[model samples]
Target chain A: MGGPRRLLLISNSTLHGGGYLGHCQQHIQKFLGQNVKRVLFIPYALHDRDAYARTARAKFESLGYGLDSIHEFCDPVEAVRKSEAIFIGGGNTFRLLKALYDNSLIHEIRKRVLEDGIPYMGSSAGTNVATISINTTNDMPIVYPPSLKALGLVPFNINPHYLDPDIKRTHMGETREERIRQYHEEPNTPPVLGLREGTMLLVEGDKATLQGVTGARLFLRGKKPTEHEPGTDFSFLLNDSNASNL
Target chain B: MGGPRRLLLISNSTLHGGGYLGHCQQHIQKFLGQNVKRVLFIPYALHDRDAYARTARAKFESLGYGLDSIHEFCDPVEAVRKSEAIFIGGGNTFRLLKALYDNSLIHEIRKRVLEDGIPYMGSSAGTNVATISINTTNDMPIVYPPSLKALGLVPFNINPHYLDPDIKRTHMGETREERIRQYHEEPNTPPVLGLREGTMLLVEGDKATLQGVTGARLFLRGKKPTEHEPGTDFSFLLNDSNASNL
Candidate 1:
């Protein structure tokens, strides 16, 4: 189906002791490839669009690719239609999804990435919106979108910047694991991928692989979450029927 | 109106290394007083209603108050009407709010607490819904409610189990302070009270006092958050006009 949908979903933009997008530089560069000369950026998650654009532009340019934010374009849908690659940076997932819906870019971007086969890259909130829903996000509902339904670029949901429970901490707030389990308690939810900091899932065609230094956790509805190390094949999750069987 | 609407909004039910509700026993006992003999409990936040109700009923019984869960009754609205006091224990904010809407108890509970002057108590997720909206909750959006609009028993919003930023940690997820600031960036957001664990807000009529062992941080739009001690008065927040001026 259209030469396999290409996507690079990163967990966090900046890892500990690193600059913005510093940790995932090589992976992003390789994902873009030599043929792609430009990238379309979506910086709607944060309140300040101009500042977000500046940070992203500097990093993308350093890697030899010109970057233009979709916010700067009068016709954002048209801009997506002509982009070589699309990158949505991290921020609040609700705000990001709301902006995507408000701009009416959901279907246009979906078609561009899924049907036309353009490379799509997302970090944190950007990565979250690429999944079935943002129900598993670790963010406050500062703003309400029309719905929790996301772009559905992938078959499963994602919890970016997923942190393990600090057994020593006295705070009674539900752990990240407990929160995701609650999501699964609701009927008919898809699988959830808990992407730790400095980790990402790279999708090329029908194959998806866990990539980065840290490991990711795969959570199914009725089973205990299984740990997956870096370089693990997550391609089974790309197919709905295959994922359900797992 | 009705002898200064009474509410005991707690930050958490269990303090670190403490038994459930053990830390807040005295405050709860004082709030309920000798006048109220029974408490109607809402334990819809967690998946197991029976288990939640049992935990709550045991705790309330030890405090010399008879407790019955709303789920046990055929008429939840009538249950609210006849209840001497109400206690909503915490688990997940979204799930609690969704269940509240599903059972059509928002208006009923509001009338019982605000208009009838019955003492209403909440912990964590429960404290979140007592505020204007659950926009500042620390919990995940595991379930989507009909609206983020909560019971609005209080004028301001709350971030319960609020933790200060851990300077030593390398995690890139937004700190509680940063998340609340992002909420403030949205238009017309209420002032957020960062209720640290082992702390709570006791609302008596027009007066709200920061109680428990720890302090709280108050956040307002376009201003730095101010630290408030345990005995600090927050009556100004009860009046929307007064809160805006501050």
Candidate 2:
């Protein structure tokens, strides 16, 4: 067994014309399973912490699962320990990493999700934290997190809401392709999984499958991005070879 | 006079159809003046060290100024100390900051520009480093720098190549405006100056004026984004009062 590396890494929480978490409700419910009655939500990415928590709680409650935001708990580390399922929603990645590091919940959450076998699900910035580091995130570094180190639930780094290069665009802003190419410059940086919006990766121990109709992009240094079709087996991405792939 | 805090902070290096440093070459030449004959170029923002320097040298040479890239120097700190004028070209802010810190040139460069009054010109990521921090940069954090602390040449932070929110765009990613708003959520984070492409800011002493044809957006927390027309005074952005103004 590849240990309990269960993950529901979503590219975005909300899609075009969909309510918050609307598009992925069934996938989320199915992923959590009937056994996990409660989930600890991490809503630190947004400014309105309470409102973000409430929104997630509403969705979880409707699915017959309870969601309590870590912000409400007296001790966040303790909350991670007791959480049967961890659901991290999308927002600013820097803010989320800042909160995670500030509360010293990084190790506790990593242990809970990767070792104890608690089902871990994340969207956007949430999915960003599940990877090796927050390096590939598109969010502005609004706040300084102590470190970019994040829970290494996945072997490779993830770029959620991954966008393709729009050749027609005249904007000088670096395209998604160029940005990831720059990421490859860093020595020892991991390969990136470009999870497009409406696309999600479902991990059941050793295997990770692209769950949505849309395909995801995989980026390796010095190589053109290769598209991974839905249902493509990405188990090789988690192997020990990845830690040294760079 | 605190020497001459002459700053030519450009929003972007190039426009759509323009050549490298196109659309602003005349402004750069005018800003540098006849006295400054040479410039020390910091091309750390680009992944290719030598190629970036060569390209920049080509442009500076055509402009009748000799450009010496810091990468070639034996002691980078010495190079900064001896630079007649400094030109920081733009690419990746994280990479730029990382190189600066790794070489221990952050303080030296800051002193050369802010205190020594070296004529400092920068574009895109280059302008980002001159701000309070590189927190608002659009580049991916491919590598972790020791800290986000950058040259506080200006009191406010800068968001270079700033694009406005497009209401018609259905992408779930946070718009430029929304991202800056999220930056405001940080308690001590400085106000961000959203500099649109093709525009630049000219700072002389404590006074700063928005240059180029387009106006710039000023984002102060709890207040609507107010536009400052080109040639309007922006000295207030550098005041001690600015900290509390937000």
Candidate 3:
């Protein structure tokens, strides 16, 4: 019974933390429990890990943790293997993905979190990795390079930082809708999770609930984007009773 | 002044034979003299237009042109536009450009065809009008929707086949070397030429040369592809004098 539902996802603490910090902290506490033991931070690529460590340290401290509370590591694999709950902070998703692929940590993380029942939390790229494909990650493709294959943890895709169409004027890339459309074209592609900022998909047992701000969108092909408010549970999507390991 | 420069480009027509029968005979003969009127073909994109057309109509005949008969779309646009002869054969340069863009075409075609006083030719989407970009001839972006801009002819874009890539994988999607690379990066794009079948880039000055055979490669970036022969004229690259437009 405690097999496939041991996940502890935390939003990236340093990603423009203002109002979103409180929301993420609350969610983290809710998932990891108040008797939190050990938390590890992984900063694999950036030349300066102190900045990331400091930001994470501050957020964790404000959430009722010690000053020297969280342990940080440049080696994600080692940190992921030893921790009770692993929190991956977001900076550059490409950098994070590269680090994961480079150190061969994805297989380990998948095995431990999904197969062995460890609490795993992610944000931004971290959250995106929860899905089967990186097709929905809201990052420019050529900014790094294209890696068609991703860590297929969940059956659906994830679009972090999902914004409305008007936001297209600001970014010089394909809209979230356009990219998702491309994904759907691939024969038998998965569903997509368009998670706006502050939105999280909480999976416990076999039930997955939508948490945080309202007005988030879930985009799927041959169907209109169904809008949902906060407290709206998407347990139907995670109906493992009939789920196939396809 | 009488025997000035002109161009005649065909999208895809096989000298050896095998594939779709696009506008080859009438267009080729329209531009080339009797001696130079044989078809030019790029076998890469599956050159077979001539054979198909000839066999289909029964009144058709083989042109039997080789690499010498066909030029790589990598020559100076001016030289291509002003040549005593010109003929662009087809195959997928997007397939061809796996070897094409590295040698560079985005810049050369613009100079030769746009800046110089030479006639230009194209067929299918080969009559490129995808100016803001240069690669959507075969691929259609929207469905009876937005008015997509292209390379502005005389400052516009061309969309040959105007609606081909969308329907067939025989032609890849609109992600050609130059188009995909430039689409998400550049702003304030251009107009285009959506040259469908039986269409051509006709500049009837005093003399017209036939280039592009089998089928034409679309120019979505700004201008047409620079014509070249792998070993003789160029080594899949244009000299500095030619590669200045992109």
Candidate 4:
């Protein structure tokens, strides 16, 4: 069995714009567990190479880091090999997933991170890829591709930008909590994560801790909402708290 | 324009069981508001009258109200002419909408409520009738009828059980928000009300007030989520908001 190591995932961070790279930096610093050395950047989120480079550079500088310290790659396999820690930035998650599947990068990311024990990081769509299925993605599923698999870094589904229940008016639909509650009613479903902005899950060597704020809500089937905080053992995901897959 | 008055609309309050006398309740309440009294109950939601009456009686008792206050009639025109507040109760919205159109009760209800300045309230299927279109409804848009037009009490679309966004998780085709968002993006479309449970919209003299703890989430073009609070002068629909005839 492979062992757990440092990792990060993103669903989306640019709420209105400008926070993408800063969010990435914060995640990188958190996941590297030290100064990040030799990181690989994927240019899949941008249409133009120059634009991607510019955006990447701006993000790196804002983080007090340099673009040259990181390797930019178009090919997934090559990028996966040279990286000590992999960081996926947020854009259109469906587009990102499509590119990863099209380039056959899913296997490389999974093998390197899950099998090779390389540190992994993702934001927004990047965070979305850490799950087994991309169904929980909040992005429009308009860009549906044949492959639905992801890096399988996390077992729970992620819902970024989770809004709370607003009680004051009449609507003709089910609430988000109600929807998840309905999901839980279905037999044998995975636990769903309603991660508000700026929350991260940290897993390293049989110990998984929620790094951000406590009071994050977990919606389980047939039960009231449960609260999870930092250092709460997520080993429930991998069986025993001490059982490392690596 | 007719002045506002009290109205009660219901979808379903008895949980899984649909009310049979729901349509009759609409006619009776409408007639009562208009001073038309006494009618008979028809079990559309239930195959048997005894079951429907039993449930209806229980509902009335729970509310400390009595069915003896008004006559229950399944007949449309006979019920419409005598009522002031038209109330439709909880049952299958599709079935209720179908029955309303099948018997041409749509025109009569509109004529009495809109033209005559009568109050109108509905629940479950009754609530479904207030919207101009039921296309956004979470329930299956099953129809034996060729066209789908609700009573059009409200001007916009209704998406009952409006769920909050979670990352892509389930294979429920598309989430409610995605569906409504796509509907709006379809070029010259109506607005949608994503109403959670325990919420209602109160209409008084040229104004619609959102009621209950969970207010409606408005999905508009080029805007973040906006809350529609109770007692705020508003429309339960998009068409009514702009007063644009579609």
The numbered model that scores best in lDDT is 1
Q: Per-residue lDDT tens digits of candidate 2, residues A23-125?
A: 8999998998788888999998998999998889888888888778899999999999888889998999999998899999899988887788889999999
DockQ of each: 0.89, 0.88, 0.04, 0.06
lDDT of each: 0.92, 0.88, 0.46, 0.56
Chain A of model 1 scored by TM-score: 0.98
- Over A1-246, each residue of candidate 3 has an lDDT whose tens digit, in order, gives 136665533333333435435667777877878665666655532335677677767777777754331334455566666666666665445456656677787787777677766666777767766666565554322223234345656666667766566542322223557556655544455567677666777877566777876446876665677788867776666643322221
The TM-scores, one per candidate, come to 0.98, 0.97, 0.50, 0.50
Q: Worst lDDT window (10 residues) for model 2 chain B?
A: B237-246
**Candidate 2 docking DockQ:** 0.88
Please state the interface RMSD for every predicted structure, separated by commas.
0.7, 0.8, 16.0, 10.4
Candidate 2 CAPRI classification by DockQ: high
Report residue B132 deviation for candidate 3 (angstroms). 19
**Model 4 misplacement above 4 A:** A1-4, A10-18, A21-27, A33-35, A43-53, A64-74, A240-246, B1-246
DockQ of 3: 0.04
Give me the displacement of residue B90 in model 1, in angstroms: 0.3
lDDT of 4 by residue, A1-246 (tens): 355666765434453333554444565665665555556666554334467656766776666554532224545578676666676766545567877878777878878887878877676667777876565555533233455556777766666555467675234334566555544543555666776555666677556566554235676545578777655666666542212221
What is the per-residue lDDT of model 1 for residues B16-39, given as tens digits with 9 covering 90 to 100?
888999999999999999988999
How well does candidate 4 match the true structure, expressed as C-alpha RMSD?
A: 11.5
lDDT of 2 at A59: 84
Candidate 1, CAPRI quality class derived from DockQ? high
Best by TM-score: 1
lDDT by residue (B1-246, candidate 3, tens digit) is 133334553333322233434435655544454544233232222234445233433322443322222233445333333443323333322333322243343354445445553334333333332133333433212111112222232334443432233332221112233333343233433322333333344444322222332222333345554332212221111122222233
